[model samples]
Target chain A: MNAFIVIAVCIVFVYTVGFALSLWKQKNKIGAMAVLFLAVIALVLPYFSYFQS
Target chain B: MKQNEGKIGIRDYMAIILLTLGSKVSDDTPTLLYKTAKNSAWISMLGIALLSLIPILFLLKVFSVHRNKNLHEINLHLFGKVMGNLISMGVLLLGFSSFVLDTSVYVDIIGSMYFTRTPTLALYILMLVVCGYGAKRGIESIGSAAWLTLFYLKATLFLALIFAFTKGNLKFIFPLWGPGTLEIAKTTGSKLSIFADFYFLGIIAPLVSSFKEFRKGTLWAFAIVVVEITAALIIFVILFDFTSIEVISYPFHETILYLSIGFLSNVESMFLPFWLVAAFIRFSFYLYLVVTLFGGIFKIKEFEYLVPVFIVIVLFLGIMPKNLTYTLPYLREMILGILSPLFFILPILMWGMAKLRGDFKREAEQSH
Candidate 1:
C-alpha cells in the first residue's frame, strides 16, 4: 500500500469516527452505522486492486 | 437588494443552470454526439432540445403546484413514504454515480490535458476539496459565485468558439445528416439525459425566490443551453470535421489549444482559469445536490456534513480505474443510457400523479 493512500484513508477514517460518534450520541444509530459502513467500503476499495497488482 | 433567507434569485438560478449544463459542451459530450451523428451532431442536439422540453415542461408544471416542496418532499407526498423513498434512493444512486463519473472525467481532463505531472489521486482530492468546501457553504454561496463569474466565463467561451469558427472549414458541415435522420433520432433519444440536470434542479426549486422565477429561469436557461451546445457542435465539426472530432476526447479544450489570439501563441492557458471556475461551481452544485438527496433519503437533517464523506468516496472511486480515458467514456455512456428513460418518464409520472390527486386544481382554487 502506498503511504499517501494510507494517510488519506486514515484522515477520512478520523472524520468518519467523529461524525459517527456524534450521530450515535443523537440516537441516530442507523445513520451512524451507514456512514461508517460507507466510509469503510470507500477506504477498502483501492486495496483490492493494490493487492492484485 | 433585500431578499428572502438563503434564497437565490432568477439570475443566480440561471447562472447555475448555464454553468452546470452549458459547460457540457467542453467535455466528452460533443464527442459522444459526433461519434454517432457525425457532421449532423448539431441536429441531434436540436432534436434532444425539443424532446427534452416535454419533461422540462412537465417538471415545471409539477413544481408550479408544489411550490414549496423540493423533489424528495414532492415524491413523498405524491407517492407515499415507502415508494417515494425507494424512487428517491434510486435517483440518488443514479445521480451519485453520474457525479462520480462526471467528476472523474473532468479530473481526467485536467490531469491528462493540463497537469501532466500531477497524480490522479492528488488532482481528484484537490478538486473535491474545493467543491466540498463550496458545498459546505451552501447553494446560496455557490449561486452567487456562479453569477459573479458567469459573464467572464461565457465571454471567454464565446471568444474561443468565435476564433475556432474563423479557423474552421465551413464545407465540413456538408452532408448535414452525417449518418441519417434515423441515426440522429436514435442519438437524440439515447442522449436525452444530456439535459437531465434540469431534473436535479428540482432539488432547489423551493430555494429559488419564487416558483415563477424558477420556471422562467429554467426555460430561459434551457433555451440558451440548447443553442450554445448546438452551435458548439456545428463549430467543432467545422473546425475538426467529424472524423477528427470523433476521436478527440475534449473538443472544447482542443479548440482552445488550437487557437491563438493575435500576438499570444497559446491561449488555452487564458481560458483555463475561467473553465476551472465553471468546473468548480458545477461540481459544487452537484455535491450539494447529492448530499442533499442523501440526507433526505437517510433521514439526516444536516446533510451538509456528509459532504466530506462523499468527497472521500468520490475521490477513491474516481482514481480506481487504471485507464480512465478508455474506461470513463464507456461508463458514462452506460449511465446516460440508463438515465435517459428515467429522466423522461419520471417528471411526466409525477405530473400524472399530481393531476390525479387534484394538486393543480387546488393551486388554481387557491389562486382564485
Candidate 2:
C-alpha cells in the first residue's frame, strides 16, 4: 500500500507538471495556474491523509 | 499536428473513440451489465453494440449524402432554419448535460475509491483543471494522446485477461444463456439505449478527414469496446463467481487487482494510474464536446475561455449527489429514460426528414 501510494503520487506529479507546462505554452494562463495549484494540493493532501489514518 | 486545422484520420478517430468508450470500464458499467443481464451480460452487450449500429449506419448514410455538413448544419438543411435551430438547441443541452454527468461520475469514482481519506472536492478541483487543460489543447491533441495510449491500453487488457484465465472457471458463466432471451432483450432495449451516446457520431463525423474514416472509426470503436467489455465481464464472472459479481465495485479494476496481487501489495498501484489516464482522456473529450457543442448552439466566440466555466459546473454536479450508490441509479435512469433515446433517434429523425424532402435526389441531380 505504501509503495503503491508513493508510485501513484509520483506519476501524478509528473503528469500534472507536464499538463501545467503545456497549458502555459498554449497561453492558457488560468488553466496553467489552476493545474499547478492543484498539483501541489494533490501531492500534499495524501500526507495529511497518512496522518489521519 | 496539421490535423489540428480541424481534420483527423480514421486512426485518430478510432483512438479517440476507443479511449472514450473503453475508459468507461471504471464507471462500473461492467458490473451494471452483470447485474442487469446476469450471465448473459456479455451477449447482452453485443446486443448493445448492435443497437448502437442502427443509429451509426443511419448517421453514416446521412454523412455520405451531405458530405460536408455536421450534425447541427444537417439539422438546419433537413429541418429548415427555425426548426433546425430549435432541435439543435435541445441537442446542445443534452450533449453538454450528458458529458457533464459523465465527468462528474468519473471524478467522484476516482476520489472516493482511490483516495479514501482525501477530500473528493480536492480531487474534483484537481481533475477539472487537468480536463480543462486537455480540452484547451483541442481534439487533435486529445486524439494524438489517445493514439499514444492505444498500445498501452490494449496490452493492459490483454495482460489482465491472461491472468484471469489462470483461475477462470468457465462454468461460472455457463448455461450460456443464463437469462431468458426476452429478459436479456428487454434489458438490452431499455438499458443499452444508453449507448445511443453514439449520437455524438454525427457531431464528430464532419471533423474527421472523410466519411469513411468516421464510419469505420465509430463502428470499430463500438465493436472493440463491446468485445473488450464482454471479455472483461466473462472473466469477472469466472474469477469472482456470479454470486459476488453483482456486488463488486469496479469489476474491471478488481480483475486487474486480482491479476496483480502476486507481485504488488496494492493492486491499485499498477492499475489505477493507467485507468486514471484513460479516464482523464475520456473526461477531456467530454469537456471539449461540451464547449464545442454549446458554443455552436450559442454561437459563443472563444469557447476555449468557457472550458473553466463548464469545469466549474461539472464540479458542482460531481458533488451534487451524496455518493456513488445514490448517484449511479439516478444517472442510469437519466441515460435510459431520456438522454439516450433523444440523442439516438435524432439522426434517424434527420434522415427521415431528409428523405421526405427528397434531399438525396436533389443532391444526385445537382451532381449530374
Candidate 3:
C-alpha cells in the first residue's frame, strides 16, 4: 500500500474510534457500533486489489 | 407574513431547488446529456422533464397525504418498520455515494480547471469543511443561504450563457438529431435520474411551511430548471457544436473561459465565486440529507452530529481515486444508472403502497 493510503486509513481509524467513544458516552451504543463497523469496512476497502482501480 | 419556526417558506424552498439541481448545468451533467443525445441533449432534457413528471407527481401525491412526514417517515408508515428501514438504507447508500462522487467531481473541476497548482486533497478538505459547517447549521440555514445567493448566481450564469449565445453560430445546431430518435429516447430514459433531486427533496418535504406552498414551489422550480438546463444545452451546442462539446469535460466552465465581456478577456474568474457558492449550498444540502437519512435509519435523534464523521468519510473516499477525471465520471454514471430506475420506480411504489393501504382515502375523509 502507498504511504499516503496507509496514513489515510490510520486517520480514519482514529476518527472512527474517537467517534464511537463519543457515541458510547452519549448512550448511543448502536450508532457507535454502526460507526465502528462502517469504519472498519471503509478502512479495509482500499486495500483490496479489485477496488484499487 | 409570519414565518414558521424551523420551516422554510416557498421562496426559500424554490431557491434550494434552483441551486441544488440547477447547478447541474455547470457540472459534467451536460456532458452526460451531450454524450448520448448529442446536439439533441436539450430535447432529451425536455424528455427527461416530461417523463419525470409521472414519478414526481406520484411522489407529490404521496407527500400530499403524508403532509407532515418526511420521506423516511413515510416509508416507515407505508411499508412497516423492516421494509421501510431497508428501503431507506438503500436510498441513503445511493445518496451518500452520489455525494462522495459528485463532490469529487467538483473538487476535480476546481483542481483541474481553475487552480492548476492547488493540491486536490487541500481543495477537497476546504470545500468539504465549508459545506460541513453549512450542513451542521441545518436546512433552514442552507435554504436561507441559497435564497440569499440565488439571484447573483443565476445572474452570473445568465450573463455567461447570453455571451455564449452571442458568440455561437445558429448553423451549428443543424443535424439536430445528432444520433437518432431511438438514441435520444434512450438517453431520456437513462438520464431520468437527472431529476432525482426532486425525489430526494422528499427528505425536506415537511420542512416547507405548507403542502400547498411546497407543491407550488416544487413545480415552479422544476419548470424553471428544465428550461434553464435545456436553454444551456442549446447554447452550448451552438457555441461548440456537437462534436467538440461531446468531448469537452466541463463546457460551462469552458464557455465562461471562452467568454469576454467587452475588454474583459478572462471572465471565468468572475463567474467562479458564484458557481462555488452554488456548489457549497448544493453539497451542504446533500450532506444534510445524507446524515438525516442515516440518523433516521439508526434511530438517532440528532443526526446533525453525524455530519463530521460523514465529512471525514467523504473527504477520504473522494480523494482515494488516482485519476479522478476518469474515475469519478465512471462511478457517477454507474450511480446515475442505478439511481435512474430507483428514482422512477420508488415514488410510484410508494404511491402504490399508500393506495393499497388507503392512506389517500383516509386523508380525504379527514380533510372533509
Candidate 4:
C-alpha cells in the first residue's frame, strides 16, 4: 500500500511538471516532448518496479 | 502612475509578515510538528526553523537583484513571455490548490469540533465570500487588516497557552534528540511546508516600502516563526505524552479544548473567530495571487476583473474535493512538494539568469 501511494505521488509530481513544461513551451516542440516523456514514465515506472507486487 | 503606487511603511510590512507567519502557526504547525516528531517535536521545529532560513536568504537575494518587481514581472523579464507565463501559471495553480486544501482542512476542523450540523460546503462558501471581499479591497486593505488582527490574534494565542500551562509536564519533553538525528531530519523535511508560504513573499516583497523595510520584515517574520514553534512545542509537551501526541490529528486545537477557565470554559470558541480572520486574510492573499498571476501570464490588462471568475472557480474546486481526509494529504505531498518549489526556485533562478543578461541593471536604470 505504501509503495502504491509512493508511485501515485511520483506520477502526480511528474504530471504536474510536464503540464508546466507544456505551458512553458507553448510554441516549442520541446514542451510536447517533455509531456510525452513524463507520461511515459508515469505509465511504465510503477508497474515495472516496487509497485509491481 | 502605477496602480498600487502607495508605499507601505515598515510597520505595515511587519504586520503582514506577522499575520502570514501567525496564520500558518495557528492552523497547522502545532498539530503537525507534534505528530511527526513526537515528544521531541520542539527540537524538530527548531531544526525546521533553522533550515527555513535558507529559503529566506534565497528570497532576499532575489529581492536585492529585482528591487521592486513581483515574481510575475521578474519572470517575464527573465524567461521571456512564453516560459515565464508557463512558470507563473504553475505558481498560480499551486497557490490555488493550497488555498483550497488549507481552507477545506480548516472548515473540516471547525465542523468536526464546533459546528457539527453545518455542511462543509456552506463553510467553504462563507469563507470564500469573506476572503473575496478582502482581495477586492486590494493589498493596502489586506495589510491594514493584518496589522489590526495581529494584536488580537497574538493575545488570544498567548491566553490559550497560559490556560494550558498548569497542565504541562516537563518530563514529556525529555531525551531532547529523538530516536535518531536521521529521523529528526526526515521529519524536518515534512514540516517544511509552513515555510512554503515564502513563495508568496515574492509576490508581496515589492509592495513593501523599501529594500531596508523588506529585509527587516523578513527578519521579523523569521523571529515570529521561532516564537510560534517554541510556544507550540511547549503546549504540546504539556498536553500529551509522546505516544499520544504522535497519533493526534489537531494537537493545538486539542490543547485549546483541554484548556478551561474557572467558569467561562470552552475558550476554543473565542479562538475560532480570531483564527477565522487570519485564515481569511491568508486565503484571500493566495486567491489574489492566483488572479494576478493568471492575468500577468496571459497578458490580461485587468486582473481585478477575473476576481469573480476565479472566486467561482475556487469555490468549485474547494467543493470538488470529496472530504478533508483525502484532500489534505494529497495537497501536502503533491501541491507543496512539487508545485510550490516551481514558484520559489524558478523565480530565483530566472532572476539570476536575468542578472547575467543585464536585465535587472537595465530595468533599474530605466526606472531611475
Query: Which candidate should be chosen as best, given lDDT against the real structure?
Result: 1
RMSD per candidate (Å) reads 2.4, 8.2, 3.4, 9.3
**Could you give candidate 3's per-residue lDDT for residues B222-255 as a string of tens digits?**
9999999999999999999999998899999999
The structural similarity of chain B in model 3 to the true chain B, as TM-score, is 0.98
Classified by CAPRI criteria, candidate 3 counts as: acceptable
> What do the candidate models score in CA lDDT, each in turn?
0.90, 0.72, 0.88, 0.68
Error of 3 at B165 (Å): 0.3
Question: TM-scores for all candidates?
Answer: 0.96, 0.82, 0.93, 0.80
Find the candidate with the highest DockQ and give its number: 1
Q: Which stretches of candidate 3 lie over 4 Å from their true place?
A: A1-28, A39-53, B1-5
lDDT per residue (tens digit) for residues B72-146 in model 4: 887777788888777777777677777767777777778777788997656766887788777767777777888
Q: Candidate order by DockQ, highest to lowest?
A: 1, 3, 2, 4
lDDT of each residue in A1-53, candidate 1, tens digit only = 38877787778777877887788889998788877887787678767644344
Candidate 2 chain B, which ten residues in sequence have the lowest lDDT sum? B294-303
lDDT by residue (tens digit), candidate 1, B1-368? 21124889999999999999999998899988888888999999999999999999999999999999999999999999999999998999999999999998999999989999997777887899999988988889999999998999999999999999999999999897889999999999999999999999999999999999999999999999999999999899999988889999999999998898999978998999999999999999999999888877777777776787788788777777778778988999999999999999999999999999999999999999
DockQ of all candidate complexes: 0.49, 0.04, 0.25, 0.03
Q: List the residue pairs that clash in candidate 4.
A: B168-B238
Model 1 scores a TM of 0.96
Better of 3 and 4 by TM-score: 3
lDDT of predicted model 1? 0.90
In angstroms, the error of model 4 at B146 is 1.0
Share of true Cα-Cα contacts across chains kept by each model: 0.32, 0.00, 0.16, 0.00
